[model samples]
Target: MPSLFSWLRRLYSLDTLDTRFTSSASASAQTAADTRPPAAKDARANSIAQGARAPLWRTPEFFVYYLFFITMVPLMFKTVVDASNENNPVYAKYSHLLSPGWVPGRLMDNSDAQYASFHDNIPYLVALLVAHPLLRRVYNLFSNRSAQSSTSSAAAAFDAQLEQRMQFDFGFGLVFLTAIHGLSALKILFIFNINYRIAKNLPRSYVPIATWVFNICTLFANELCHGYPLEPIAMALSPGSGTPGDQGTLLVQWARTLDGFGGLMPRWEVLFKVTLLRLISFNMDYYWSLDYPSASPIKKKQLDPAALSERDRVKIPAEPAAFNMRNYVAYLLYSPLYLAGPIVTFNDYVSQQRYTPLSITRTRTILYGIRFFLTLLCMELILHYIYAVAISKSSPDWSIFTPGQLSMLAFFNLHIIWLKLLIPWRFFRLWALVDGIDPPENMVRCMSNNYSAFAFWRGWHRSFNRWIVRYIYVPLGGGGGGHRPANGKPTGSPPPSSGLGAKLQKICNFLLVFTFVALWHDIDLRLLMWGWLVTLFVLPEVLATMAFPAKRWSSRPTAYRVLCGVGSVGNILMMMVANLVGFALGLDGLNDLLASLTGSYLGLAYLISCCVVLFVGVQVMFEIREGELRAGINLKC
Candidate 1:
């Protein structure tokens, strides 16, 4: 029993062995190999990388343990399927489809409003993807290149053509936005111009503050205005109300006409949330570029060459001319990433235009496509057989389920949520890959594989994680220390050294980041609570790792490994609870779940069994990671 307890703590400590995500693209740029580190990197390639060989099947103990886990998979499915069938007997007739001839399948619930929108728009996305390359080709053939110097060398001229190609692509994106959004595109353009002006016209010292205020306000204003209907404003400004004769008439007509044009994509704010992030990226990158000592006027050398590593290229500031209204507009409205992004920084996006990353090869992209389709098929299977989403939506009596069944219901629902997001992000990213742009890969690990909270967040929506780190966390002093401005005062007021103060600062930074994340997702109180809950959940693990720094006890291998295992069990439990509250079940549902588990003998037995199962599962997770390390791959998630 003591050994088992120690093993649990060891699981947690083992997780802390991985390095934190790198600070910024600039920090990466100083290194040659990384402009932006690939979401996953070769373990052999990075100095911090660690590798070990620990094959599960080689050890009898693990082989039995893993076999049990494998066997439980089908049982877990049946548990949820039984509960779903019991809850919705009407849908039980569709059970025949599961066995054979599963065609033209039915969704027990199509109530997921967000995914419904994406599903409806698949044809449109497909059309856009199909047309993108053709559009680029047309632009290359017909777009004037007379502006380039005819006497330039082959490399220089080729570089200029690529530069011009990006210009065409960016402009084309604006047109794409307009087609889908109609007059609402003007609203996006208006916000873009406002943000661009702030970045350009404000003093370098003042840009970050002004940009944050304006963009954050825009986000709130957008929600408050409900995408800012023009007709209502026009009605308020009508001549009969107060404004003189024809003065408001023409304005009213324009506003009404603009309102009419919004019919194509009335809910423009959905995409604008993502667009808002790009706005911030542009201004912030522009702000930092000004501080770059090497920044100079537009020059031919500013066009990044094919030879530059992605890390250096991403950090290298584009010339002053590149920040113009046209390019700024183009970058913000870029089609593939505009709706939902594996966000690329402004500098990174511009750099890719100069030369595609070496990683975006034909074989790799095709492989990615195959992976995406397989995952999509997996989602389809889950949707058809599990009906977790439908079951969750229906809100059946929770008390009826055995604790294990209830747990699986929540677990499978989270899986559905993960798959829904993963499929769409992969789809868009694959589209970008086809177009020779490599946005960061978003979901890097299975939801079940994660044991650490930090690792979970790092791997989940990974590009967004990087975005927050660079633009938000680094600026706030979560990096090595706070970034110093020209005034030489640290912005984040980071602790002078590591101790209680540093940990408090780190917690505060996390709170701020998660708060922004919640707000960015939506202006909902539930999400805000979720964010706070996640931070709270992360606290114990953070404190635990600090209290028992792995190195301090590394010499006592038996005791240390056991200690980490214990911590890992607790961390995994907390992570699952937090995620359930945030994504699968709400706070009330979680409360009910806990109450039920502790209320009765059966529930208590089930809960204990789950913990036992989780302990073994976490060990397997550790070994899987170890296997990856042996293979010279480390995702650092």
Candidate 2:
């Protein structure tokens, strides 16, 4: 009991973790401190010219993981089939069409209609992974002679630009080749049978000639999603009515247009959806660029007053432009990350265009890639098992579940949801290495490595977090710790940080940011409930930290150190529980479950006791693993 009190006294030791997400430059510096240290050099590599060559592809760990992943494709297919619960399933077609002995037929030429449509992509993605690197290497070889002997400033500048990438001719050559092959794949695979259109209830049909007719509708259908005309109309009519007026009433119309097809569109429209932020970033930077010329082609063409809607024209005023067709095209279709992404800012995307990227280590990069690949495989298998065993609510074995089982279910379900993204996110980040660009890493660290909501947000989906920071948070007056008052700095003394007003503002801003993120993930009732519930506890959590600030107690006795260590573990466990609860439960289900926790005295006591045990056990587990408290294991960040 005294020991628990001791922990309360020294609780602030974990303050080195994630601070508030702020746009302030100082806050940015603090966030960097949380990132993993860069990889180290291998001395044996330096002896062979620049470096010892990485092992051949056959022996490489990355190659092994890829081979293993392919081996498990059958199991993945079976899981998908089982989850679908169809009378005549997709995988059933696979066995009928495929020959076991013939590997290519089994993998690619399978007679399965779905697989047949998808087979072209299997080859295309593989070629894309290799083509850019090999082509760039070839370009470098041929251009070495022509790059010498240029004395003019223009030539130097041009060479400098070329050095950032392979020569311009090759870049365009690769682009045209990819675009041709890409268009063929889209036409053959995506365009047939599926009703790709604005009308939601339209049945599937074959139309070779008119797919583009629907494509045009799909593009324009998005104007309604953005609340373009509705927002402008609402503003004109309502003026001071901050409520959702015409635009607010249209959410269902908007949801039906997008969310009705969200699942099918994840691999299709999701590419365009994710890249929208990059476009916004590009437009904003062009608007603000000091050197942008008024008469630039991009300005005259894309931002023409007649071309943009009223809302867009007002919100995104024309800035001078310096157009680079290659950069803009590549930014949109950066094939490695196009399917799913870490949402690279336009600046990072362009800055990486340089010909030389020093961080490309064949050995280290491949090793990291293999690590992610294997981790992803394990997580995916876990999810597959969980789905098979646990997802059916009406199963006859429902009586076998316990409260403890429900807790674990919550844990695994949330992990499954997050792992779905982590698996693909990691694979693409690895693939991006072939392009010589290290897009920002996601899921750098999560779960036990974090002990607070702030830390969790900072660590997970970091690229998305960055986009939110740059485009949303900063724009909305991001937690500026100091501010000049609009009402002119109340008469005498300045306001202090500890005041009730400041505290409420801090909590409000944090919750508001999280709500925005939740809504962005999906505009669903379940997610909205989760976001608000999680935010409810996080406010009190911030208050707890402020109340019991950490103290080192360096010269104090062993008991004090032990108390602090145990308390830190308790905090971590509690935080993770809240996260799982937030993510695990549905809108109605969460309310019922939370109510049951405290509805009975026995239930309340039992739940509290379980938490206490888990809290202390976590500290003991870490000590057993690391020989000290909070000794974090390094990961492939």
Candidate 3:
């Protein structure tokens, strides 16, 4: 059987070669250095090339993803609209399910409940799963094809090489991760018996079952659900009744409690402080700390006073820049305007600060502000409508809903939360475009004059992405080092300065970028998990960058490359675990479980420990940034 298979394979290879050889030999060959060309053939070739390079919107993947998302989004929207309707059985069932925990006269009135129903939309979850793969593939193909067409007739010699090199572990790993998520989704639907398309009559005992189903479903919903577990669960756990009557009673009791305690402000203030602390902690851990520089070069004893005085410091140093914590923080907080940054770097920030006048850029800034405001307005309108519809219906008996109907209702609520969460991305982009301006040098270097234009599509709503690139990528020797180019030359010249041992430097970059990203988003175990998971790409890139400072890692053995690829797959799994944990934590039931476990441990010791870790992280970041700035200043002099 093996011999027969080999013979067939050989025959297939011969046939392929014959076809290719005949086609090429019969085709008209042009002179190697022709001054003139055949117009008709040249036009045809140009047409073919242009077709291949067409915008992503024209690609099959893009269209498929778009169509799928569009369909799903509307379907989910309809589900929410139906559930919020006063006459809907689902609304009545929801009210009944919540009445047991409700204080009469405190819940939303039927009219308000009607508005809230608009929140139910499972389509967003569907869209996330279906759209991501298509978009990623399209982007990968577009990048590869563009690279191939840019080279000379020697393109064939390097085409295979470029293709192989461009095969990033990140993209392939994500696909597998997505597949697992898809399977999880199917499991959710089957186990929960969620009829996501319908708003239906259901009984009260079904509430718990529904809540469980929704929570499970939400876990797999992706960014669309904004990490909310499920609606039924939320309603069951809500502070007030499902109807206005319950809400009024709850409010009165709350007022009485406040009167007994002197006022609500004291407790409210505590809540506010906790929220602020959490936000700071979350951002620090996920966004800033992971990439916090190792230490100041002056502290590390790596900086040389003699080298600082050299005139031709531009002669790329042998060592890459060392990780400095101060540089990271400075990059993070340099521009007060970008404090809520679309994350930028010390170098990019400096360039923009020096070149773009605040007064001159006011018009562009105003427009961006307007855009952001509009997006906020739209989100508010949607949320308001949803709240009004879903929270005001007449209460139903616990006996009214089946387990299946209850589950569907819970899933419906999860959809509402997701829609609410996504509102931030739109406004964030607007804010970045308005507030973040690129310098003139950046315009020339980035191939665009409009700072907002560059940021509009890239970092405007993606401050964390910018943060990763600047604080993590640049320091580990990714971004064009801290200096501007001379006479508009390409920045890809051989390195002249190296500070961190090449291997260590790369690893530092990966760890910092992924770690910071994980911890910056939330101060939870899930974010920590995510940080570790994302480190997959960071670790390899760091090693690869160090191994071949001049991009020579491509020549490394295939076995080594395969190992890196496998490691990346493991990273993706870790990320998925992190994301799942995040979703679980967002659920009230999960929070209750955790609180039960840790509430007793919220002692002075725990508080002190947290403070100490925070202090060390911040101190490290500041020291690194200060060292970098000093080094930069000296170099400039």
Candidate 4:
């Protein structure tokens, strides 16, 4: 077994295998210029990996940190537990699950329905995860045997066979989802088919507009109609089985029978939201593929499918045969990431089928698995001891807890939200890793470690952030003139004439990005407000960066660090308020929280103490990043 210290090192290290894995289509363009000999990259990697700085325990400054950590952690736990146990009705019901030994707190199953679904169906999920690869291997063994005698070059034959096998895999995935969703799966299929047809047949220019409109419409339709149930339609058509042996009655009866399996994944719409992202990815990729300059007839004949370049793999559109319905279906419904994605783009997903990344090694995967189980256990313990989620749902009397404890309620609740998402994303990603596909790691840093709103979003739901950047942010010209002309001339619009115009354009882009993100999460007004509030909170950091560019202060390290510390404290406070409003509490609860915090002198003192503690935490976060830098890793977020 690895030493405990080694495992701790792995846990703290930022350059885990998945962190280095690229899932964005935008990043795939770098693969085109990746001709630097492997040894050069390896040497640089080795130099960076040569040694780490002294451990935290050895650092003198960290003694203060250790003191703060040791004091604060237990106090926060006690605060959360004491607050939870204080006549909260949810705790009273689950008191039997409470333990009084070391951590005296009530235990209960998670109250969040989405997470509970995953928790409840672990046995089935595990069975599917186990059986999927075994079945795939069996299919591949026979496929390779049958394809060995094909009249093609060895590499070309292998490539052809892989695509053929993918068709089988994709078909199987559709069937599997259909089995679980019953007739409800047809709604997904119908939407997929429409998008597929649009990509294949529509003019390249129109594809983007059509794709966006149709998919966005489907979002509303899914919400309004609830995954477009077919059972009602079937019942109407059959109407008590008018003619027992009639073909129409038989067909309608089959539809009703198929609907029975809806219980397996009852709210299929939950999964459809994720599927919508893949749909956009596929259509947009297809649109861009159409725009790529095609090869000459001579080059086309000479082109060996297996000898394709990185540019060919990513940027250049594949042959019509490669983008067919079969592959499209497989890419959309690939079982592991089909539910909750550390979303991989269509191009990236297809490319990985042929060339699995070096990052998905057995050791790395095992370590990832260990990390996942550990996180799950941590989440379970938190749920058991701290009834924060239950407390939040039960509408407790907030007056019972002191200001510090009230703060912990929101604080721990956000952490629970973080873990709820992190555990599931990591679980599915682990499954993908075991199957030799590397999806992006969703949570690269702990929630408490972040001070910058922008950095927090980038690290949290990181794959989705990447997806937003690639599909939504960049295309809308959000980040520094996305897809601008190579010569720096503006294309579709006149240049922003003034500095204010440029800033406004950027802000508008952010609003749109967050709006879409909010709607994507769910079509709720509260989330929309959350999105806008996030945009509002990020502006201070933006202005601060403008005022204090790092290059301008390189000579005055002390002043720069001090300025950053102050700014981070403010950011932390703003972020907490924003998150509390969005996730843990609505505006009313937040208003009540703010009123309670500033309601009296003692409450005000507690608030100041909270800020001081957050400031210290931010310093540790900064040190953690510095440590990463010293060890040759720079996770810029």
Name the best candidate (by TM-score): 4
The stretch of ten residues in a row with the least summed lDDT in candidate 2 is: 15-24
Clashes of each: 23, 7, 76, 0
Model 4 C-alpha lDDT per residue in residues 1-637, reported as the tens digit of each score: 5798877866544434354522222223233223232223444433544543344545676688789999998999999987776475456644443334323434454677767878778788888878887887888788778865664666565576557557766877878887778767777788888999888788776888999999999999889887766656776766665456655566676766766668577689878888899999988777766544465321554644433433344444545466878888888888889989989888777776765564455666777788888888888788777877766666656776688888898899889889999989998998888776678889988888898887898888988998888777766766655643223442234436677677677778888888998898888888888999999988898888878898899888657866898899999889888777777788888887788778989899998888778877887888777665454454667
For model 3, how does the per-residue alpha-carbon lDDT over 1-637 read when each residue is reduced to its tens digit?
Answer: 9998965443332111111111111122221111122122344333433433123345564456456556644654565545555565555444542322123334432232222232232244235434543554576577767764454555343343323322422344224323433223233224223321111223433432443344324333433333223333445555564575554444444543433432211222111211222222222222222222445332354443222211111111211221123222233322222212333333333223222322124443444345445544554444433432243223333123332222233343433333333333333333333333321111111111111111221322343444445333653455554222223333223233564554455455556655654544444566676456445434543454345453354466444434443443333233333333443233343333334333445433443443333333323332333332322211010
**lDDT for residue 184 in candidate 2, whole number 0-100:** 29
The predictions' CA RMSDs to the true structure, in order, are: 7.3, 16.6, 26.3, 5.4
Query: In candidate 4, how many Å is residue 252 off?
Result: 11
The lDDT for every candidate, in the order shown, is 0.72, 0.45, 0.34, 0.73
User: TM-score: which is higher, 2 or 4?
Assistant: 4
Order of the predicted models by lDDT, top scorer first: 4, 1, 2, 3
lDDT of 2 by residue, 1-637 (tens): 9997754433321211111111112222222223221111212212322321223235453365455446544544444334423232333432333323222322222222322232336456567678766766676567655666544775355345544363443354335434544332242223221322211123223231233245434444443354222334444454554454634435434533543332322234324445455555554343233223445433555543222321222223232221244455455556677666867665555444532233345644655555665665565345333432233222223223334434454545555556655666766777787566666667755343444456567668887876766555544445453222223322122333566666676566667777866655555566665677667767655676566444544355345535545555556555555554455444444445455555667667857755654444443333333311112222212
lDDT of model number 4: 0.73
User: All candidates' TM-scores?
Assistant: 0.85, 0.56, 0.32, 0.86
For candidate 3, give the lDDT. 0.34
Q: Which portions of model 4 show Cα errors greater than 4 Å?
A: 1-3, 17-61, 86-106, 148-154, 231-259, 296-316, 484-501
Off by over 4 Å in 1: 1-57, 86-108, 144-151, 238-258, 294-304, 484-494
Across residues 1-637, which tens digit of lDDT does each residue of candidate 1 receive?
Answer: 9997854443222111111122223222223233233223432334333334346557787888868788887888989877666355534533332332143543333345666577668788888788897778777766555554463586676567657766876788877887878888888878888898899888777898999999999999999898998877987877464355544566777887878887457888877888888899899877767655553422334533554554455556776667877778778877888888888888888777776665565655665676777786787667666766655555556676688878888888888888888888988898888887778778867888888888899899888998898789977888776655334566665554857877888898999999999998889877888899889988988889889997799678557756777788888888777777777667877888788777899988997888778777777787777665554445666
